[model samples]
Target: MPGNDVRFLLVDDIRENLVALEALLRRDGLEIHTAQSAAQALELMLVNDYALAFLDVHMPETDGYELAELMRGAERTRRLPIIFVTAADMDETRRFRGYEAGAVDFIFKPIDPVILKSKSEVFFQLGCQARDLARQRDEMRAMALHRDQAMARLKAHADNSPLATVELDCDLNLRVWSQGAERIFGHKTRDMLGRPVAGTRWLSEETIHLLRGWIADDEGQDSAPRYTTEAIAFHAGGHEIACELYASSLCEPEGQHRSLTLQVLDISERRQAEAMRSLLIGELNHRIKNTLANVQAIARQTLRQSTGLEDFDRSFSGRLQALSRAHSILSDATWSSAPLDDLIADQIKAGTLDGDRLRQSGPKVQISPENMLRLALTLHELGTNAQKYGALSRSGGEVHLSWRCEGEGLVLQWQERGGPHVTPPVRTGFGHTLIGASAGGQDGSVDVDWQPEGVIWTIRLTQGVTPVSGDAPVQKALTSVTVTEESLVGRRILMIEDEPLVALDLTFELEDVGAEVVAVARTLRDALREAADQMVDLALLDGNLGGEKVDAVAEILSRRGIPFCFVSGYGPEHLPAGFRTVPIVQKPVDPARLLSVLHQISVTPVAETL
Candidate 1:
């Protein structure tokens, strides 16, 4: 079927003439509309966009000449092609009238079919061509509009991007500078555009040569689309920044270079982060090796002191736990220091004797993690002896523990009373050797008074003491203690660990030791909230919570006087500066070590926060 716009109009007074004219013009892809009068043809012309109009010269009311003149007067059909037909005799005057009335061509009645068809075909082909031309114009206009919109979007993306977008002419003169370029190099678009790139401090002479080489080399091959490289760029302030550059050249079809585009990305922060990661890895490696060596030392020492497998297991396990306890305290203080009182309480168990049988008196003191572990093991041996043969073995027995600062040194005393008669051991065991070694530290002294009533052990440690000035002795007298894991039993503990597996393992470990895990937190906000809870008795903290330091939480815990220890794979350097003295437990935790820390730092029921 023909398109509605491809219609042709035929008007005549006689039906035969109109039919003959329509049959001559009709063909595929063409529609013919017939009208018996000029009024009917005018109506059809107003409704349809006709390609051509054939008018009858001899009409009833309006002749072809008159109709053609009228058609030219109207805007819609003003440019429409018209052909006139008639049976009137030929004359110059009539022909002049027909030509003056806007007829493009004329045909007489009884016209030859060949002449009629040939003349109408010319108008038909012209109409088709004109229609195609109009459609092509519309399509080209739409395409132009789309191209403009796409360019606008591309420009917006380039201007807003963080990567520096730069365009330079073949002469290395800047042609374009985006907003990101201004931010990265600290030069405005106006200042950079049309300026020689070599004039800027951002790019070196060698870099300019390389950029030029890219354009020169691009003419040879099309394999490598983009050239990537790293370079040192200078900021406007004269400082150096690391940058990664991605460059590509734009050229004509004949390989003539038009311009070059360079995308610059600042990688200064990324480089710093990578360096820090390497440092941390090295430090971690060193710490791991040191820890393994220490563990080997403990195992060897325990083996030498053992009488059998059972003895080795008991001694080795106890020592490791004591070490772990010291670490836990240090971790709490971010591996800085441990308290003297906590270290003392960790070794002695209340259930080993009557609740009132033990007494403690000491001013608050802080010691290094190394010293804390040393003192803990020494006290553990002493407590073991008391439980086996001294005051702790009998219900009516009594023990008194006390410490005081003396001339840049510390004096710790252990006295037992109301037990079986006392006597010196036939052989010096590992326990006695450990206790004696405690005094050998810092050129200190040891004195054991084997009195008939019980025994008295005193040691003077000359090093690793930070005394609290004007702090009167804290005299703690605890009673009604339970028998099992009494130091940690019923204690409300707050735990902060980012790792889910570690937190779950630790929760079970604490619970197994009779400590109540009041709450567990994996983030800074949660840790702070739990730390502020008054019901919290103690805390175990992971030094780093997903790259953030737990300084604020530690501060809250310290201010509240709630005892806490740290668990970390990192050393003191990674710890919170303010809480460096807190105990630290290394990663790949030995449960015994954690248990030891809990026991060592436990406080009595009557103990107050401050």
Candidate 2:
């Protein structure tokens, strides 16, 4: 009824009758394409999309009945609505033939306009509704296909994810289960589908009761919502596994209930890790307390047994402090790993080197915490020997320590020079037996070369050292800074820093050296703005800022032919990709060191800038 305007095709041999029918339907906006003969009417049918056709039965050639039969034979127009306008005198046999030719209705001649208008309107509304319904059906089919594809993608991700997933209906029947569920629960989906969840035997009684209670409370509610619970479940192999279950209710349109979806995940490993972490904390506390008590006992007994205060201080206090330093080194490494250089530094500070007498030179290397403790004791004994008769005893004498990576291992050399003349002792001391025996026990070898110049000791170790990779290339420090006569006075440098303190410190340091700090940007937004507007000669960038990386700034500066350097606390191994070619200075940088790096960049040729 909403779109009731019908388009009609009127065919007749007389033009006067077509005009009379058109006048009657003029108020309904009927579009009438009229034809003088049936042959012309058939031609009009070929080109137009008409809802209804009115024909005159008593034509000379190709009468209305014949034309209707022809129209019925055409595949394109076979279903078109046709009504005959004829004289009442037509016989019953001719009427039967008209019906057989696909005439929907017949009108007597002198053609009543009122009957014609009403019949045409009905067919037009029906045609419009049928077309609308067809379009709606096509749209619904496309939407269903798109929704199916989305559901398929979601199912694929759920199956592939590490977290286990399972779906169950309101009656607790298993519906959908993912491969991850099989791995976590050790149950195959084929054996579990359509089975009651409580009968699975893997679900604990407590978890089953919780699920039942939640469902019972939400009963009779059309808007079935989501809920979550965590509990322990048993695996197929009879192991108790902690799992977190995410459950949600599925419903059809019009608020009708369908089923429930459950996602199960095994959290057993995480739970066990938490429990073990608690035990480790308690154990660490007990060990530290016991170690302190042992040290106290040793100190009191050694002091009481000594003849004088000097002997008590040398034997009891110093040795306990040396042991304490070893413990500190182990603690700093989180009891997982330690740097050999750090262990050596800590031990030397406790005994002979006293900070000023220590001279360490080596590439960075990591050692296990267990080996670090053993090496700390060995080094403490060596330092004691040095303090008594070696280089550490004299003011000018010092220990020259160096280590390097060998084939699949590490070799550390500790040589003493400029102290007492060296010679092999006739009798091995307690320290000599411990160092030599411990090194050999760990599948390592120690060599003591008593040269006339000094005591040269080399230890080769096979374990607890990590070889440097390509990402962390070796960088040797310059022995001293080389300065030029040319001053960097009045040269402008752009400072891109995130921290206010570091930026302020750099600004002061740069101004002190006769260089102007043109602009300081604390974020990428501000830096880009300054770069676009200001004439920046050089840029000093921090690698990480608030949610933005410094690579973009570097790229912008590079394109503009402005030189820049990266100042970061991260090691060379952690630097951003493509930043290897860019110059970098590690932080906690000395003012003089920063100045030297900036000066080098300023003097570098333009072609060499990265």
Candidate 3:
């Protein structure tokens, strides 16, 4: 009790000695607990922790020496301080034995209370200091652990970052260079580290002087060495590189001086991109100016060749606007490529149109800008021709456009109906030649079908006629054939879907087949819980549940001896490898088809389950 605080334990064979010891040591901030005999002391020790044990050496059954030996043997009281209270004069051997039994000091009977209080006070102070020291050590250790973690994270980021980085000291000595630095500079760390920065033949004297000045000003005068600077440095191969330098100080504990930390970054690729961007901007400006001049010349030529002012105005504005729309479509795709659907949409939207009289539907397909521009011009000519003499000129006419994949190519159909009857033109014009010749050059075939009801055209071309990549052809294979509801009767299922509506629909379908919906889960967490908690026979998992990967949930059910299937809107390629082995039911699923698959999976042995 006299350890951490000024609380003392008083033990004596006589009650008189305990009372005298308590009277002497009792103070404003001191606490004392007294025990009459060694047995009572040992009982107190078993129940509570004592800072010090004062014991009478002379006793009837068990003495202070024996109690001290027992205290040292018990784990709880082993480290406790014991002082012998004796009337007899103990020899050097007895004092040594008392110390061996874990006594801190010895006190004579008929004691001096002042000496007793003073000795107890010293032990209390020592205990308090020891506890404080232990707490400080724990705080230091926690701080050290936090610092280590921060340093490790910073090191990992620097090593893995794409940007090249290097560090140099104030004395122009190479200190640190990340893996990116080696990739960009083409210099090994072993060749550069601990070497003079100038030896690399990359750092210019001007750059070094600028760096030194910054370090001295920030680190010396202001006591803060943190700055960012950009310059040109040479790579190991002597190629000029754009670079940014960041410098900071590593100060010692005393804060008298500092070590410089220079973070060097190579931004050559960024600079090159900027230069190329400027060149592209200039090229675009030149093309635009030339196009504008060409439009002006075309307008002049059209006016000269026209039979009347109305004809001249109509022909000039229409052709120029068509050219403008083509240019706009090309610009939107960064002049790389454009979607075929998008090019057609832009052409139709920009040209004369009756929105209610036209409908367009097609599979998504991308086309190169070169092909798109020519295609746009062709479409514009066709739309203009229709407006002048075809269905578009009529009040209640309509045009329907659609496209579909045919083998390795695309077949686009343009049909006009609900218009005045049409007849074939006597002669082909410049517009017809432009549309025909342009498409022909791209391995495309166009057929103009002039019908009595309206005109129709069909264009067939390879999917990737342009310089754009085409999406993989979607293959819908019949994994299983349609089956009757009676085939699925009495089948059991474990439905795992996150959507409430989807789950309800699936349950209804299962019930329609005279089958049972054994269990349903809304999340991967819930699904896993159910798989472990329920007796699942068959599982139907949604491919994505609240953004969690459903494959893991499927794996859980599979491991638990359950047959499972995946339900997803995504294509087969979107699934993980070998996931195809697991049957996939595409969304907007047929109730009868789902029942058939569920029946198949329910009867399938767990050994064959995926």
The positional error of residue 7 in candidate 1, measured at the CA in angstroms, is 4.1
- lDDT measured at residue 131 in model 2 versus the true structure, 0 to 100: 57
Which model, 1 or 3, shows the larger lDDT? 1
lDDT of 1 by residue, 328-405 (tens): 667777657678876655454323334467788989988875567677767767777788889988878888888888
lDDT of candidate model 2 versus the reference: 0.74
Superior candidate under TM-score, 2 versus 3? 2
Predicted candidate 2 versus true structure: per-residue lDDT over 1-610, tens digit per residue: 4243446888888888888877776654456789989889889988877888888888997888889889999997799988898876878898898889998888887767777667877887776676567668888998999999999988788878877777776677888878888888889999889898899996888887877766666654656678888888888899888888887777756564556677777788888999999999998898778667756765776666567887775655455555656665666566666676566655543334545555666677777755665566567767877888898788788777778877656787888988887889887754676567554237789999998768888888877777545434233321222344346688898998999999998898788779899999998899887766679777788877775776677777777778778887654455567657777755544454467677878888545856
Q: Give the TM-score of each candidate.
A: 0.57, 0.55, 0.52
Error of 2 at 451 (Å): 13
Candidate 1 residue spans exceeding 4 A from truth:
4-7, 35-48, 57-76, 86-122, 145-164, 178-191, 222-225, 234-240, 301-312, 325-610
lDDT of 3 by residue, 222-289 (tens): 45657788988887888888889777766556663345676677777788999999999998898778
- Cα error, residue 565 of model 1, in Å, equals 24
- Span of 10 residues, lowest total lDDT, candidate 2: 473-482
- lDDT value, residue 608 of candidate 2: 88
**In candidate 1, residue 146 scores what lDDT?**
95
* Candidate with best TM-score: 1
